[model samples]
Target: MYFERAHISDEELLSFYKQLLYPRMVEEKMLLLLRQGKVSKWFSGIGQEAIAVGATLALDKDEWILPLHRNLGVFTGRKMPLQQLFHQWQGSPLGFSKGRERSFHFGSRQHHICGMISHLGPQLSIADGISLAHKLRKENKVSLAFTGEGGTSEGEFHEALNVAAVWGLPVIFLIENNGYGLSTPVEEQYRCEQLVQRAAGYGMRGMRINGNNLLEVYHAVKEAKGHALNEQQPVLIEAMTFRMRGHEEASGTKYVPPALLEEWAKQDPIRHFEGFLQYLHLLDTEKISEIRNTLKYEIEKDINEALSATSPAVSIADELQDIYAPAPSAVPPPVTTPVAEKRFINAISEGLRQALERYPNLIFMGQDIAAYGGAFKITEGFSDTFGKERIRNTPLCESAIVGAGLGLSIMGYKSMVEMQFGDFVTCGFNQIVNNLAKIHYRWGQNADVVIRLPAGAGVGAGPFHSQSNEAWFTHVPGLKVVYPATPADAKGLLLAAFADPNPVLYFEHKALYRSISGPVPEEWYTIEIGKANIIQSGDDISIITYGSGVHWALEYAQQHPEQSSYILDLRTLQPLDYDAIRTAVAATGKVLILHEDTLTGGLGAEISAWIAEHCFTSLDAPVMRCAGLDTPVPFAAELEKNFLAKTRMHQCIQQLLSY
Candidate 1:
């Protein structure tokens, strides 16, 4: 898996680079845009051109590549339309953001390559997940992920490497070590001798190559693809390159030493690679001249195309596109399928396994969800049975994982992408909020994606790992928030989410890993998404809940037989079955909403407002809600429970009954 440094003509290493410089030219113009007060901020992949151009040669156009903001050359070199990119830099209607996202944060799902995020380290994990889908589909395509040396400092980078390495996923983590993570020099960034060696920490092999050498970049990526596709393991290639200029076209060189720039300018990748090609007799002087002149023409053409590209067609409809999958067949069997018995995790696992079996397009992705069976072992034995292509373990980049899920879902794959810990979802908020949520609203529901978060606090998971931010998602109008309280609902709800046309955020409570077990059906079933599930019939009070709180409400109903109470599990937060809630509220006259998220904006408040608005006439007393106090989930077990929804759920139910 190692290749000695050799300069040869067997492979034209400069294939991607020959056309890459043109984009760098565009980068300069983009900087002009910043100066003109067009773009607010810009992150250019100016110096690290070889990796972007060369790596594209190792990947198939049908294969996916999720580049970070630093690697725009890959898209331009790969023949991504210049107008689209120009639309991006200019923040025009044609820009990938569609008026909502930041500049240069563009991705074209149609091209099979999604846009990139500015945050360090998320793209690595996102690429790992997409590779999982390609593997599951049994496609030879590998996902090519890009990042820079400074991104290595992020825990997501390590998390992604470790998970993809362990799962043997078909993903290539291309770490372009171009010397700095912003003003901080790499030496200040890390203590490692070579960044690639860090891969060993995750039990993976890595290598360093002269990043500026296009041939070296190509050779490294070729080997990486082999290890990735054939071995199903991840590979890290530290392309040791240098940036010749400031970070952005507008960035001042106050921190970047003039001597270093002079030294790097001498090693210009564009000139160096072209000269190397001629020295190797791969091209004559005439070809070199033609390439330079042609690249100049091309670069100018890209700029003109970008400038005159009709501003990407001003369309309000573009905003409604690529948000969620299509709605399930409204004619789904009206009667329920006979339910059988299974465990909670098994229900979710089996439902996904069965969904994969039933739907050829369904794919499962998350950290250690394949061979290792997920952190909770829900997907154990799944990869072996469905093969790594279907059940995939991704790199631990939450944002990238979510973004790549956005890409594949746009590719028409029903992707179930997860953030290992719900808390980690913070790593990918932009992807979730901007991309996933807006896809439907922007282009009339043009996306098909399912994002899963393992949420809530329990099991002594401390602060970094535990969170229930379902309330945050409830605010997103285009996304459907579904949190099941039972095994059967978990299976059924997932089935529905996969089938639903809009993006669905399925939040799985970590605390319920074992506490809230129920009989899941052996037969495949999908509970309706966006609809609440009522667990118990009551007359005195209505305990409405979802996820973990649903169980607590049911337990309360069982324990307090003295009060006949009804329970409605708002299985979904968005498109909340207000009709269902009103019906329940009208009958019960007293409502208690519960959840594990913080109280300030907990989903309960929304439900209460909706009920108070529509069913105010039916209320016997006042509607009340139970939720965790607004605070981080404390590590102390007793204190955490006191801060959790269990105590809150009981209190709310008690208050409702007393009312």
Candidate 2:
């Protein structure tokens, strides 16, 4: 069923032969470059180039391709300049990734190809998101995502395929079943007879293709593309092929059996295709020789030109500047006028409502976010007002959702995604920390995404439901962490987060969602991220906190007026308001840091370290911390209170005052 004769015209069939030879020849050249130390690494799909060539040919020019490291043929087939590809391998700034990444780990914004991260399975979900975007726009375009047999075992693979199937998105999951995943054989990776059979569980059509047969692969992908575009159906195609070399050049083939290699070499895709073309009278020795010579000359010239180009002389400042989205030149100061009293949840809903009204490109996605209005009703009536396309209810797949949001942001859309519960964010932590956080720095890409995390401990929500994990985000470099305390700040910071160019992790305290109320402006306002707000003025000691900690610190100060304690609410955690901390420490000569997260290795530790380094002489006493105990949150109300530091803020303040 997988094998087929040439279905294309004579001219097209001849061209197909060239496409198969291109990556194979290029891989050979790259291997030599690797030995010469001109290129860093080589992940060659030398014997399996037909799969990429065929798939790329099947997709339309406007369609997107999410390609993996071994899919070099896809890049070349997309007409990506040989010089640029050589430049990428040679580490020249002229490469697609600006030398931020080595080899095929970068993508082209112009061509709609996503340069994949090392995590093999994540790109499938990202492609699903891109396909979702196309579906939302009512475009006929489809997305083609590539992965290896080993990647099919990853949780993201199932998440991506399941979501795509559930939505009936126009996407094709192309799995290169090359028998081995790195050093492990397919026998060890899965128990299934064929990986394509897994699609039945996802309710998607599945096909197995002879990947080494160019015509078979091309026809399979061509049919899949038609299925996706016409029926909005996702199809999983397992291209059975062989890895002619090690996973990478450094990864030797010592583990591969000699007899198996010899057997597969006889079925080498390039050789078989060339022989088939000869049989069809499409080529002879003279024609093949001429083609090889021309391509070799062109490739070598490209290699030489790329080698002559300059590598980027990136400085620490230059690298750091790329760590975040470009800051806005200037933003108007936030409006402090009170329009009406509102709860924190209402403020957040209103903020999102205003954002959807303001930006046409902004989208909201989360589990139960549309008709259900999210788990917290933060988006109640959003689907009715904004339409289901804009207010999307995603499957319970956090990693894919985050990845999809990142993909949308990459395609010039601003996404506001929710975690449902902050603790559930761990499920999507890979996308947050690895892909979303590093895209800008690695490839000069801006994931203008806002991840709304309903975080914090209170209400006896237990360990899984209640975890103040802001410290986890603050530790990552590319992300901006914002934890607003008041209703006004919640609304303002959320707006600011959406406005900011970089990915922002906006931590909306779950406990403060309905518990806090204050006057919030109806007019659109953006609180500058990374700025601190002084809630109360005092002189004896400064209490620095954020989120729920702000209220606790304020209450502590109100109870002990004689202590003259000041309350500083740090709205943003990553780009912390160090200046405010310095001023407070210099004025009070004593500092008390309070937070809902556990004590050890918390943001408090970083704050205390900075104070000791820069504000050592300003301190009249050692910095004190009142933080949650180093243990998982308990279920009972009294145990939860004892587990939190909110109850001990006043005690910590008194101790700092005495010191």
Candidate 3:
């Protein structure tokens, strides 16, 4: 209702002008602040200001927005106090509610504008689920995410859009088609004629508009809102604009060549809009002058005030706050012991299946996870039973599939993410590492994600399909890592993960998925994370193992009955069970740690070090560790077997037994 032809009035045009001028002036002031060392850093949305302000006008205050980097205009359009933004630029806590969140990634959950990210693609996936929540909650708000055309190439983008298109999610995917992506051209980033065109393949509508024309953008976004809310379908809008500046102010455009710069600069939306507004008697020379003068004063005041505001930049303790909302230190929720418990794998499925019953927002998604029962068939019969709404068979873009799951997680959905093969998880590292892991570290947000990777290098999966990458993720903070060795443990560990409030990486070893199936109670139940399960007891030597290594230790104890041995299943790796380990080592006086990862920095090394510290006094000899040789797991069956198997675990224990 703001534009007349677009149903927006002259008053709205002036408002848009005021907003645009305000951000432009802020950029100028901020750049100067940076130069004077008043502001330590800056990223600009210079020429693309009009559409940013325009998109904000189409928003309802209750709606949520997740914007990628270079969305300063959009950030301010939502009325992030200019001074707060300037203070954020100057590294002040006043700009962020959580003292440690990134500057532009500001969040006022009260305002419903979640945050922004420097990483591309994943934010869009999260937007889809947030929008889906609005649809389910019957809220009239839309969830919108904006990104550059360069992001179109990321699998996360494809995954999010495919799900949105299939489910008709009430979301908007906005592409800021600025010609360059860090020196890469749009043509190089994609094969599609227009990025928007790909939406139709996913069963969503697509629209394009003049990125600089505030009126066009406002109207186009307004048109999409009805379908987004009413039909619960997504729409792709490509705002066609050239990057009048480099990717950022500090990004030199020397690669663009001066000729192209002049060409794009001539089409500067501000100058063009000035001509259009003056022609319509909406904005003339005198009004433009007044607006510029007012904006300059406002910009100056915002920078000075923001820079002057006193607040801590960051402190070490803030590192753990928002990862899980830091609930009072209490025991994990008790796993329900159902009266009619079933098999372990099935029990786990039931726990996840029943999770949807507890929280309707919970969704289970993966490739063929529904009727096809997932690639491992772990979710077999879920689609037929839970319906497609809960179970999904996503395309093979692991990046996007996981990214979309992450999207739902951020929106408070209990998303049970499944990757067919453990090794395939490497494909979605961006979503896991950049977006999922950093959501809390970067902005103190609980992404609330649960990713289940069927890991270990056994069963002849070979190099690409059979590698254990747990060590890679153990290095990341703010994520709970678990390796459930048995059926009962799987059911209990998975239930506990769902109940917990942080991002969890559930590594279900493929070798144990069906090979070692056992009875699990029909009753609901959960097992505590960060606690080790004792499989067998002996005092001669203590062997700490997890996943397939647990089985090896058990076999060793059985085969060598004469020598007493104790086995510890380290179910959770991150929050280790040091008490159980120390207790076992004290009783045995010798410790042997084993796992399937490489020898250098595998879980075994850490366990060995722990024993060397706390249980060193009780130890009779130095701790021994056995793991896969530090090399790629080969394809040959016999070599692969010798390569990944802990053939040395039994031998290492024998050596410790001798000690």
Number of the top TM-score candidate: 2
Winning candidate number (lDDT): 2
lDDT of each: 0.73, 0.87, 0.76
Better of 2 and 3 by lDDT: 2
**Whole-model lDDT, model 1:** 0.73
Encode model 3's per-residue lDDT on 247-282: one tens digit a residue.
656776788878877877777767777777787798
Q: State the displacement of the C-alpha of residue 519, model 1, in Å, after optimal TM-score superposition.
A: 9.0
Clashes of 3: 24
Candidate 2 Cα deviation (angstroms), residue 226: 0.4
Candidate 2 per-residue lDDT over residues 593-638, each given as its tens digit: 8899999989999999999999999899999988999999999999
- Tens digit per residue, CA lDDT, model 1, 500-522: 75678888777776776766667
Q: Could you tell which candidate, 1 or 2, scores higher by TM-score?
A: 2
Which one wins by lDDT: 1 or 3?
Answer: 3
Cα lDDT of candidate 3 equals: 0.76
Better of 1 and 3 by TM-score: 3
TM values, all candidates: 0.76, 0.96, 0.90
Give me the displacement of residue 655 in model 1, in angstroms.
6.8
**Distance from true location, Cα of 82 in model 1, Å:** 1.5
**Model 3: per-residue Cα lDDT at residue 161:** 88
